[model samples]
Target: MKKPIYRTKDEELAQIFSSKVLPRLRRLEFFGIIMAAIVLLVVILGVLALTVFRFKVPDIKLRAVTIDNYSNLSGTLTRFNLTLREEIVLKNQNFGEFKYDKSEAILSYGGKTIGEEEISSGCIELTYTKLVVVLIEPKFEGLGSNQNLGGGTNSGILTFNSYIKLSGKVNLMMISIKKRTREMNCTLKISLVRQAIQDYYCH
Candidate 1:
């Protein structure tokens, strides 16, 4: 047999594999391995989103909203699941897969609650903000007046302020992406006027 290779105590080792210098590979438990993998994946994804993707979200806006079938009731609420359609503009600052699950519209007059409605559930995929419509129900039928939902009714030329709240999640569209994080919904608001229609909502 050839002589075994050996080095002096102070010999310079070109390819030295000293036990102290070797990487310590402990016998990993299943849970530990899984946890490590998840952590590694998260760190990589976070770096990607922060660096290559540079994905981000901005506030949403209600460009144009209209109350349809406003004149159906003859001086009272016509009670037909009244529809309020709106045009929204979303601008995505970063490259990301954005989506929406639930949306809402809250209408308040002069800083008092008027109505809060649930528009719909949907998904939007992209970095750029697009216009989306929300249909909400006041959940109550009433007369030619404004009323705060969960509050009570107030009347016309009233201070009309509205808030749109959203809930959803997003995915990073990349090969390196493994674990996706839940994204909070982007939302916006619009100030509007609700003129007393000749027709109204009556219970």
Candidate 2:
């Protein structure tokens, strides 16, 4: 060439901007986008953990069982009647609220249903305990010569069993996320002398 070319400062700066600054800026933008996507994924996983993956069935227990009434404790016991009262305790240890439907508590003897009662529908708050009362009236029949009855009455003790089941849904974030069922079975021994429940076991 005849002479050396001259470049302006502005041109030099423009060339630097296009070659270095622009690519660096694009890389920063891409990094920001990836970071944003990761954050969004974490939030979604947290929400699922609290509302769906951590769900569990409510805990149910029989707090107490007692005999409210009986017919003629001291007699031939050809035919007898019994009235029982039960205290059911519901414990909720979840982050969501539980709302159950109407259900039943049944009383049985010798694999036979002798009495039953209705339990009203209700709700249990998170980490709270609820108490429900149920009444059962059992009618004894055809026990004139049954060995269990004859032996129990003569020995001054009577045995019975009770069952309860509850079905409901867990409510969280204004949505019913899961459905659960809980149940309890108990065997009780009644002392004729005390005219009350003496011992019991439940599962």
> In terms of lDDT, which candidate is strongest?
2
Give per-model TM-scores: 0.44, 0.77
Where model 2 places Cα greater than 4 Å from the true spot, the runs are 1-19, 29-33, 36-40, 43-53, 71-80, 142-150
Model 1 stretches with alpha carbons more than 4 Å out:
1-51, 72-83, 110-112, 137-156, 174-203
In lDDT terms, how accurate is model 1?
0.49
Residue 160 shift from truth in candidate 1, angstroms: 2.3
Q: After superposition, how far is residue 141 of candidate 2 from its true place, in Å?
A: 3.4
Model 1: how far residue 188 lies from native, Å: 13
All models: lDDT? 0.49, 0.83
* Candidate 1 TM-score versus the reference: 0.44
Instruction: Show how many residue pairs clash in every candidate, following the order shown.
Output: 18, 0
